[model samples]
Target: MAKALMIQGTSSGAGKSLLVTALCRIAKNLGFKVAPFKAQNMSLQSFITKNGGEIGLAQALQAMSAGLEPEIHMNPILLKADGNKGSQVIIHGKVYKTLKPKEYYAEKKKLWNKVLESLEYLKKHYELLIVEGAGSPAEINLRDSDIVNMAVAEYLKAPVILVGDIDKGGVFASLYGTIKLVGKSEKLIKGFIINKFRGDVEILKPGIREIEKLCQKPCLGVLPYFEELSLSSEDSLGLSYHKTFSSEKNKLIKIVVLRLKYISNFSDFDPLKYEPDVELLYSLRKEELLSADVVIIPGSKRTVEDLLWLKSLKIDKILKYLAEKGVEIIGLCGGFQMLGKILKDPEKVESDLKEIKGLGLLDIETTFYPKKITTQAEGYCNLKENLKIWGYEIHMGESEGDLNLFTIKRFATKEIKKEGSQKESIWGTYLHGIFENDDFRRFILNKVREKKGLTPLEKSYSYKKLREITFNTLAKLVETHLNMEKIWSLIKL
Candidate 1:
């Protein structure tokens, strides 16, 4: 087995994911081929691979840092939240089933064989594997069948690096309590790092010394919060996500997404955030979205509930205003389902809400279906704006609308256009990350300009360049705190 160091946390959002990412980058910088593994991940933020698989965005970031193509082996199990105490379970890039909390707990223990298989795959191939745990393993109630945190590290015999978020307070207590809670002080915990700290370093040294003494663990480093890195977050919850911009300057394209409760895959717009002059804004207030050059409706876990919620808050009126003002409107995935004549969940795929009326901007009707189309598809996109783009489709509904307006050609293994878009200023599609394609990206950027009666910006984007920049920053972050030589030694052993 390759040497390994697991980065576990006292709780969720303790900066474990970012630490793993930086470590992977730093390892690559030190000439070690490193890979990241998470035995289990329960989060809403997900990534669609070029090969049509799904995994958490955190592992994908780690893979990028390691200079490797993201694969299903990185995150063997991705549990996507589906609201009301349920999650869609994904095992090795395949949808296993939709399981309620209790139901999932029962099956998780049985899934360890598969988790071990993925870990072994990485262990044999990569020089090192940086593992991450799910939520706090300290939930004593959940210790019996702990598949994510302490259980996985113990299974792999990997030394643990406990990460605590001091910004939340109780740093010493959290570290001490976590070790006590796990009830296993085998001296396998190599060290610790304090993440998301603010203020003078001199003052924090005392706290760091105190933390080391209280936990009886080496204080590896105290990492101050740095916002300039522009690190893309793995989960939307409490994440400081920024939009991407192009190096070539141009007029700003202000695209505003309405932030709703229970948002599912809002990361679909992360690519857009990087666009130069394309200001991506997320608004929950109706008035705040009015001045946006383009109004977007992102996917929601509960489409019916969110639509009803939007209707209650007059989001329909605001969308209508943006449309009337000649502003561009784009609806993606679940958002596309809501833009049709009606979003009926007779089959209850998304929710139990019988049927809800849509915005009717696309002249389409969506029916919640029993079957899910979780496959990769590609094609051209041109309407009020001309663009040829490629993207992936994973949705649970059938849509019917004007096909001529928005032409869709799925790449492989399926022929279905249950949901689609319009040709005019308004467009809708049940596809996520389709804008990542250059042709599609150019079209949308130009359409935003077209809506504003402006010319398309000639400056283009380099996707590879952006990835490199992100990875480089992450590597520096690791070098700043982690012991690269020690981590590499762990990975090799």
Candidate 2:
């Protein structure tokens, strides 16, 4: 069996995921085969594996950091919130069922078994497994049925490193309290990692010493905040921290993404943040929507419900006005469905409503089906002929329209099919991560720049290359700041 080490956080956004990602890369750099595992992940940001399995985006990125292909075993259970329909529970990367909080907790025993199976599978394949815990392990109300956090650590006999965000304040209290709350599992917590610290480590030394003394565990390290850290967030809680660029003299393009109540995969636009001339912000206000040079309706887990939300806020009217003004508007996945003339859900796959009116930005219609399309796709832009692009599809609706945006094929399949629709300045596609493609994204952005009477950028940075660089940077940061000697000792490396 492979050695395992777990990273549990003091709170939801206490930087557990990034620490695991860094450790995975650190292990890989030292010539050890490493992998990331999460017993359960409740996040809207997901990635489709090569075999058409859906897993959390954080695990996928961590697998990349470890120089391994993403697999379902990395994240055995994924819960996606579906508005009034409760949460969509995925077991082993396939949709299991949708259940409310009470209903989900009722099946704790069964879910725990599945987590064990996945953990065993990863143990046999990799030399080291860096496990990430969800929320806080200190939830006393949830400890009885917990499948993640301390439960998984105890199951694998893995040493746990609890992390607390110093930037959130109460770091010492949070760490001390978490250890006290875990009860018998406190023995498994070998150390504490203080993350997102700003200013002098010398100033924090006294507090760190006190926390160590109180918890009877060493303070592994104090990681400084990295404003330039460009990894995809695990969930929506990190959305507010996204940089809002001012439409200043240097920033030419103002891209506004609608912050829907049920937004999923908002990280689809993360690539745009690297562009020097572009400014990105997520907002739902009518004034903000109307002021954008480019407006994007991102994917949502609950499409029909979010569309109704848009209507209630009168954001639907704003979108139409923007469309009439020739402002560039784009929709992705569920957002693509909302841009159509009508949406029909006869079997009620997504919602109770049989039919709902869309924004009518495109001359298209969508019908929800029981089966979801989850596949990696490659294609070329029809507008810029032969400009190749590739991305994954994760949607339950099929759109019918006369206008087509790209010619594509599913991975390992040769059947050519038309995907997406474009009419004038409005574009809609089911492809997630479309903006990650440098050539195609630049083509679309340059077109908008030309219309605004600004010079188009001749060259743009490669997002794929940037991701590799980011992984290395994170690994270097952890290695430099943290006591790797203690970390390796815990894993028996």
Candidate 3:
């Protein structure tokens, strides 16, 4: 059996994911075989494993840090919100059911067994397992059906560390209240982490000592805010990080994404943010769109509902004006469907509306189907000399169009398909992570640069290499601030 420790938070967005990732890398550096496990994850930002199975992005990054292949056992259950009262539930990397809050709770017992089975399987292989808890362990209304936080900690007899965000204010109360609300489960918590501390550590010492005295647990350490760290987040809560960027460089290309209400896969543009000649922004204001050299419409969890939102806000007219001004426009997944002439939902898979008019930029029509296509793909993009590209597809609707921009081979299959559509300055595709390829990303940017009469960048950026450097940077940062000796002692029997 593997020794285990869990990082639970006072609330969501308390830096639990980042802390787990750093520990995984630090443990791997000490010559221990490590793995990351989360009993359940609720996020639209997901990754496809080598076997074409889906898992959370944070777990995938942790797996990379541990020098191990990402697998289905790492994240046994995933819940994708459908922009309604329900969520699409995935068990063991496959779609099990879609249920509302009441219906999901009705099946809690059966799902608990499934979670235990996955933990037992992962324990047989790794020497140490770093577990992450979702939301909060003290959610009073959800404690009875909880299978992710204290439930998993009790099952493994793991030591717990409660983390609270000081940036959100009232850290002392939040930490003390969380410990109090967990009742008998409070004994498992060995210490507490105060994350995102900004000012001098001396000012916080008095409060920290008081908290430790009240809760009967030590304050492990206070982690400073890293303003320069750029990594893929697990969900849209990280969207606040993508505000304004005022670059003084000459001829900087500004790319703005139309931040949808139910945006999914926003991490698709993380690569673009790192480019030397690019400045990425997400906006819902009309003034922001007028300054953009290129406008991107990212994937949405509910295409029909979001499309209606665009119509309601009159952003549809703004898109047409931009397209006519010779600005480049790119639509991905649900956004691609919005570029078509019509969207038909005969089965009402997404909403109550049977059909809706599209942006009418491309001569394509999409129909919503019950079965979704989820697979990894590699292809040759239709640029000058055909740049090789690779990405994955996760969507419910397929399009019928006359123009094709890429020919791709689906994973674990011999079949080929002419996918994606392009017309003049507008391009639409169902592939996410299409810009991860260095040659392909640079080629697309060069096209825009040539049109704007700006000089093209001589060197291309490698996203894969940048990710490795980022993981190491984070590992070093945590090692400097955290109490590693105590952490190691707690995890050991």
Against the hidden reference, what TM-scores do the models get? 0.90, 0.96, 0.95
lDDT of 1 at 87: 85
- Model 1 agreement with the true structure over 227-284: per-residue lDDT tens digits: 6344556566643333545453356777788777767666677667767668776776
Report the CA-based lDDT of candidate 2 relative to the real structure: 0.89
Q: After superposition, how far is residue 453 of candidate 1 from its true place, in Å?
A: 4.1
lDDT of each: 0.75, 0.89, 0.87
Give the poorly placed runs of model 2, Cα more than 4 Å off: 240-251, 412-415
Going through the candidates in the order shown, the clash numbers are 14, 0, 0
Could you give me the TM-score of model 2 versus the true structure? 0.96
Worst 10 residues of 1 by lDDT: 239-248
Off by over 4 Å in 1: 228-230, 239-251, 383-387, 404-419, 490-493
* Clashing residue pairs for model 2: none
| lDDT tens readout by residue for model 3, 1-493 | 8999999999998999989888899999999899999999999998777667778878888899888888888999999998565999888777788999899999999889889988999999999999999999999999999999999999999999999999999999999999999989999999999999998999999999999999999988889988534577777765754543436555678889988999998888988888877878888789979878889999999998899999999989999998999888999999999999999999998788889999998889999988777778898987556679888888887899755889898884646998899998899898898987788888888888888898887646698888888888888988888898888899763
Worst 10-residue lDDT window, candidate 2: 241-250
* TM-score ranking, best first: 2, 3, 1
The candidate, 2 or 3, that scores higher on TM-score is 2
Tell me model 3's lDDT, rounded to 2 decimals: 0.87
Q: What is the lDDT of residue 329 in candidate 1?
A: 84
